[model samples]
Target chain A: MIFYVVIFSILALLLVASGLYAIIQKDLLYAVISTGVISLILSVMFYLLQAPDVALTEAAIGVALTTVIFVITIRNTTRFEDENDNNKVK
Target chain B: MFGDYQNVVTMSVYGSSIALILIGLYGVLIKKHLMKIVIGLSVVDSGVNLMFVAVGYIKGGTAPIFSPSVIDSKPLMVDPVPQALVLTAIVIGFAVTAVALSLVIRLFKHHNTARIDQIKSLKW
Candidate 1:
């Protein structure tokens, strides 16, 4: 019982922190990685709560497949705009 | 103040999952990026699945199975319905994610940019 409390608290904290990181990240790729981590953490939390089916799905689809898709998209696109426009003005 | 052990765990899961859900919804509502929207969707899915699994747990229960020693006795087992539902949901989620990603790829191919504001061919 006590263990469950501790696990839940920790998982909840991690979830919040990951979500905040995902939002505040300057690099879009970093944001995607943080989001994937949030999914992974949630999957483990599901297992601890006795939801093995959900956990398995989250691990395979959310963490693995989704992350792959995001990374591919990021690779295909430019990461950031040229900030050297400011230097040219000077 | 449900005194049952299972009820306590269920309540805790609900509170935590709801918090996750709210954060996910806030992201989806505010974020402008296409990829971020997909991530938010997955987060919301996780919270809902957690709620389903928590509802299935029973106090001091074992899995539902038949054995000679307990064949005639009533068994208190966790519900399997949520597990089955979640399995179906997971597959459907995968299909949705695949379709969404394909659409994102097509959007990028048509327009040079993936930003929501930059792709404005439809806007008058």
Candidate 2:
């Protein structure tokens, strides 16, 4: 009983922390990776909450496919948020 | 308030998911980069999926799968409906993400930029 509580609290904290970091990240690639970490933690949370099917789907789709797509898109474009506009005067 | 283990666990789970959703909303509203916005959307998708599973959870209940050896214990199964619905939702979310990314690619090609503010093709 106490074990479950402790584990749940820890996972919840990690989830929120990673999410905040993902949002506030300056670099696009780092933000994408942070989002991937969020998904990975979320999958484990799903499994701990007794949804193995959802966990599997999340792992495959959220972590693997989504990250791959984002990486490809980044490759085709800029990597950083201020990469192109850093030298411009506003 | 954490004395009741089950209630506390469920509440915290739901609360964290709600926080995730709100964080994603902030990202969508405040972020200027197109890819960041898409990432926010994906985060929102994850939060909703988490909420669905959390709502459908049954304490002390096993998975809904039926086996030859466990056919007699029908009452121990958790709600299978939400799980099935989430399965479909995950697939649809993947498809939506793919389509959204493709659209972003097209937008980048047309505008020569990925920043949402710089793309002024449809702006009035």
Of the candidates shown, which would achieve the greatest TM-score relative to the real structure? 2
Please estimate how well model 1 matches the true structure, expressed as its whole-model Cα lDDT. 0.70
Best by lDDT: 2
Off by over 4 Å in 2: A84-90, B1-3
Per-residue lDDT tens digits for candidate 2, residues B39-99, read 8998998899899988888878777777788888566767778888888898898899889
Give the poorly placed runs of model 1, Cα more than 4 Å off. A80-90, B1-12, B63-75
Model 2 fnat value: 0.67
State in Å the error of residue B17, model 1: 1.7
- Candidate 2 docking: what grade? medium
| lDDT (tens digit, per residue) of candidate 1 on B1-124 | 2244545555556776787688778877977666666667766776777777767866556545567888888777667788779878877876887788677777767786656867788942
| Cα shift from native, residue A71, model 1 (Å) | 1.4
